[model samples]
Target: TFCVLLAYGMLQQITGLRLQDSLGYSSSDAIKGTGALMTSSMALMACVQAIIFKFSVKNPARLLLIGALISVLGFYFLYVGSSFWIYLAGMAILGLGMGLMFPANLALLSLNSKEHNQARIASINNIGKGLGFAIGPLLGATLYQKTTDLPIIFAIGLAIITLILSLISMFPPRIKSVHKI
Candidate 1:
């Protein structure tokens, strides 16, 4: 979570001021409204994930997979957005996907893990997030520099990858036995 946050922070920090200046807008306005919008979506997603977990913690992967696919659609909206309303709408959907994945992934991992190894599992998951933060900016910059169409390329690529992951996640081997303690 922190890594994703950091990655987004870096993106705004690096590009927000410049983009605003280029567009003849105040620098502070560049990223000012995003947090408010994202927070609402995140809060709603947290509630949904909690409710879903109550029913079937063991099947949260299904939720994550679907969420990932939704993320792709959100990205598509963002990539082609040419107006404020469109951009905000895309952001709303993107935030929804993000919100859905976070808790759902954690719940699924917890369900699959042994209680004694919970800490280790969490640590490993966090490590991947850290790596994403550390690397996201460089990758983003490279793509941005490669062509003027960075957002579209990124949205398309993310959509493809998410779709693939969603497909894979849907087909997990069925657990045949339920152990009761």
Candidate 2:
């Protein structure tokens, strides 16, 4: 969750720069491009979340895995994108993947916790998200100053980590078998 949110924050900070610098968007127009990305993000998030709630998906990890897979593709595209339209596509795809993951992530947090510990678990999770959000933009800015590729490449790396973690989360812990005497 932390890493994923961090990548998002980084993208939020860098998207405009990428537009203006790489794709020749005017500063104001670059901001508009960011707005477009956000719009697509919110739109997909709302639609996907609605469906998730409606269906009440039981296997949150499965959803997380699928979302992570999509996210990997999205971030990869963003890294390689040389044109404005491709960047927009990458952002929209990222949004779609996150939209699918968000609800599942929340579900897992609650589902995995006991009623007694739920609040504590949730608070910890939120703290991770908060820290990620707080740091991502700063990191993004720093990386952007160094090189545009650095930000997206870092984000792509984080998204891949998220995918690997999702895979790990998918399986249940195995119970050891005992031999009876």
Candidate 3:
């Protein structure tokens, strides 16, 4: 949740600036373009979420890992992209990655929790997301002030950390079950 929001927050803050500076768009046009990009990303995310739900029943961990890696790839595209179309493509891919991972992670958390505590856990999860959203834009903006690439660099680092954690979760330590007579 944190990583997801962190990436998104940074992207949201930077998109307009990128459009104006890199694409030679007017201020109003840049805002509109950014809005369009964000809307397309959301639409793609919805579609991807539906597809993942239909196809990926077992091995959500693998899906999660794939999603994280895909997000990294998306960020890489954003970093290197010179055209507006490429930026749009990166946003779409990022949306797909977020769609794939968020549901799987939430489902996994739900499956691992007690029924009574489910609401609390969900609330906590949302709180974490909220915190990430609140903090990420500020951090990204501050880093951007220093250098345009810094926000992306920070986002990539966070994505890498998330990927590592997902990998670790995939290979959890085995537990021995005890039999009672």
Which 10 consecutive residues of model 2 have the lowest summed lDDT?
37-46
Model 3 lDDT tens row, 71-150 = 88888778887888898888888888888888878877787789999999999889989988898888878888898888
Please give, for residues 117-153, the per-residue lDDT of candidate 1 as tens digits. 9999999889877876776666656656665356345
Q: Considering only N, C-alpha and C atoms within 3 Å, which residue pairs clash in candidate 1?
A: none
Give a tens-digit lDDT track for model 2, residues 1-181: 8988999989888889989998899999999988998688668867888877779788899999999999889888888899877877887888889888888888888988899999998899899889989999999999999988998899889988989888888986898999999
Number of the candidate with higher TM-score, 1 or 2:
2
Locate the minimum summed-lDDT window of 10 residues in model 1: 9-18
Ranking by lDDT: 2, 3, 1
Task: Write down the TM-score for model 3.
Answer: 0.91
lDDT of each: 0.61, 0.87, 0.84
Highest TM-score, which number?
Answer: 2
Each model's TM-score, in the order given? 0.70, 0.93, 0.91
Clashes of each: 0, 0, 0
Those runs of model 1 whose alpha carbons end farther than 4 Å from true positions after fitting are: 1-26, 33-58, 174-181
Model 3: CA > 4 A from native: 177-181
